[model samples]
Target chain A: MLGYIIRRVVAAILVVIISSMFVFAIFFLGPTNAAAVICNQNGRCTQERQALLEHSLGLDQNVVPAYGEFAKGVFVGRTISTGPGAHYDCSAPCLGISYVTKEEVTELLKDKYPATLSVALVGGVVYLFLGCTLGILAAKWRGTTTDKLLVGSSLIVSSIPYYLVALLAWLFLVNEFNLFPKTGYFPITDDPVKWASGLLLPWLVLGVANSPQYARFGRGSMVETMSEDFIRTASAKGLPRNKVLFKHGLRAAIVPIITIFGLDLAALLAGTVFTEKIFDIDGIGKWGLEAIPVDLPVIAATVLVGAVLVVAANLIVDILYSFLDPRVRLA
Target chain B: MTEVLHAREPQPEALPTSDSDPFLVVENLTVQFPTHDGLVQAVSDLTYCVGLGQTLGIVGESGSGKSVSSMAVLGLHDEKRTRMTGSIRIAGKEVVGASDQAMRRIRGKEAAMIFQDPLTALHPFYTIGAQIVEAYRLHNHVNKKTAKQRAVEMLDLVGIPQPDRRVDDYPHQFSGGCGNAR
Candidate 1:
């Protein structure tokens, strides 16, 4: 088991490295010139200024050498020359300075990441619990009015566009009804109450929007699980009705649901662009969106971060699968 | 004179037979499904009886309602999808149209079924020991340790080696031939 985990971890690191390289390559090959972007940020983009910008940003060098510098920056610390002799010391695992803000990309990401994580974590828990509960209820009450109502409602909700639902939530729940306070992000350390209130709307919007999909998945898998022979065996064991549905049936149904949940949660953590944008939260998602075109370094960092998050989530899911399903042998 | 005599005479109620009967009896059981195509008859007018200490082997070809009939005996079929007629009695207790609560009381404790495929019959997420323990704990008033002991005893009874150690193992850890039975 230890060997298997080690092998998996190694493979996950390799995937992150390869994906980061791809993101780096794409940034260099793209139409937008990093040097021009930097020069443009200075309120002027003359040819002389562009050339100077290219030299300072080290973009004038070949792509290979530039990539080498980036790679070195990740392993050891690198000094970033703002202009002439002015330099800033960027610590290890540096992602370079943003061309627009001249701030360390890593530092910026660190500042903004907590908000995104808060939204995703809270929203993920709500949706998973709500979806699975509704699904289990539907499955246990199959063919009854309650089952039909839940399934129908889930189908209807899933059929609608997610962005629209989020938009509607903001419009009615926050703006019109004044059900929740103004949507924004506040650091929890500063004021816990403000932090909770500020993020409540986004959590609801994101959780409710994502729940229908989970509900549908849960219902389908649950229906299938109910028909499994083990379910019958469990029923035949004279287990209570609740135990048959929850213990035996729902346990099997949760595997596929968790797989979907891992990927969804990872994506949300990396960036919830719509949720953050609609709610005006200064999260990593909003930051990444704003950085595009003007800041290649931040965009590249976001890509690498996204890849790492996805890989990590998948690894967690695989480990969880082994625990949930004894039939699956990791080795 | 006849009317006066009838008024004085008392009647003996002819109640259904009690106590002296087979352990399980299925009489004129018919199961049918109405699909979009048509009404498909799975089992037609099937009748069978099993006494205590009797083993009945239901032999039939594929699609001949062998599994269907047995599943009906356990009340495993989906009530919404299939139409069932007639009666299934277990030790003189009516199985057909029994409430879910009643079925739960009688199912594993009074009558149980050994499924055809062990691989599919056993829950993959649970260890064989945990599954067996759960089954035993459901019908019996036993704690975790006692339930586990019962599980081990059951495993040993099924010819599994090292029942104490094997109780910790999962279904995948067992060989293919160890068909799951309870």
Candidate 2:
């Protein structure tokens, strides 16, 4: 177990290394230039100011020194100087400096984490429960009218794009009927009521749209699990029907579910740009898209955050594997 | 006058014990399936009973419906696809056609089950003792320490070595092929 933990920790470090390279590479390979963006934003760059920015920001320095500074900030803490507005500690283990904002990418991400987590987790729970319950009921019926309707509805939901559904929901539900407030976001602490209300509609939109796939996934798994001998055994033991379903069948069926959830979390965090835009949420997805052309720091931070979430999800799945099904070994 | 006086006696219940009634009984239970291919009889009019503290085994290879017939008693088998008709009296209470809430109440306290494979039966991440304690505590309102102590006792009873120390060890720590019975 110690060895496994060590190995996992090393692997995590390697992942961060690779992710950092990707972040650097994206900026390097892309058509957009951070310096040009800065120049454009500045209207015109005076020579002294340009030289100061270039030398200080390491445009004048070689890529090695620049990357060395970045790595040092990322891995080992080191203080570095930046603009006059906010005195960034610029300690070691920093992701990078924001080209546009001239702020530490890590700080920017840490500040906004709650928003992303709130949106993802609450929405995830809503969709997961609704989807699984509906799916099980549909599968129980299998060929009846309720089953047909559920399958057809899920199919329709699956066919429609997430953004389009989100848009329709927002416009009609929030704008037309005025049942919900217009697309807006508030921090949970800043205003709990508004925050909950805001996410409620998004959750509905996201849940209704995403739930079909989950329903199908869950139903298929349930159907497959019901055929397993253990389920039969559980039932035969004169265990209640609920026990047969929840105890044996549910656990057996969840392996695939967790795998899907891990992948889904990553995809949602990345693809949630549309949802964020529609809902007017100032989350990383929306901000990342907007900051792409102007600021590399925000983009880098976004990528890092997304990668962290994906890693966390994987860890959670691994831990859950040993829980959901006893056959799995951590080693 | 004699014909008018004569009365028909009721049929005797299957496996009626001398001292007390049997805990569970199944008689003339039929479980069928209607498919595109044909109507398949999964379990056909099978009868069996298990009294309190009695172990009953239904041994058969795959598709023999040994398991299916038993599932019918619990009403665990699907009602729509597979047709089940007959009596399944559990602890003198009818299991078949029983309400969901009522069946849920009978599951763990009145009866709990372990599967053929112990590896699958135990949840991997949790310690065996923890799982057992949880199972015990779920049905009873005992405190954590009391539950833990009971769990430890159960571990010792199940032949787990060093019950106190091993109580915290996860299921993976156990050697393979124990095949624990619940």
What does fnat come to for each candidate?
0.95, 0.19
Clashing pairs in 1: none
Local accuracy of candidate 2 as per-residue lDDT tens digits, A106-216: 777666666666777777777788889888887667778998899888999899988889888888988899898765668888999988887788877877888998899
Among all candidates shown, the one with the greatest lDDT: 1
- Local error of candidate 1 at B182, Å? 3.1
Q: Candidate 1's residue-wise lDDT over B1-182, tens digit each?
A: 35323322332222264777788889888888889999999998899999999999888899999988888887777766877777778877766656667777777777888886778888877888888888788788889999999888988998888999998877767777875544
Candidate 1: what's its TM-score on chain B? 0.88
> Which runs in model 2 stand beyond 4 Å of their true positions?
A42-56, A75-89, A266-271, B1-33, B40-79, B82-182
DockQ of each: 0.66, 0.17
- Candidate 2: clashing pairs of residues: A73-A93, A73-A94, A74-A93, A74-A94, A76-A92, A77-A92, A78-A91, A78-A92, A322-B125
Interface RMSD, one decimal, each candidate: 1.3, 5.0
The number of the candidate with the highest TM-score is 1
Residues A49-102 of candidate 1 have per-residue lDDT tens digits of: 888888888778787788888888989979988776679899989999988888
Q: Against the true structure, what is each candidate's TM-score?
A: 0.91, 0.72
Chain A TM-scores of all predicted models: 0.96, 0.89
For candidate 1, the docking band is medium
Among these predicted structures, which one has the highest DockQ?
Answer: 1
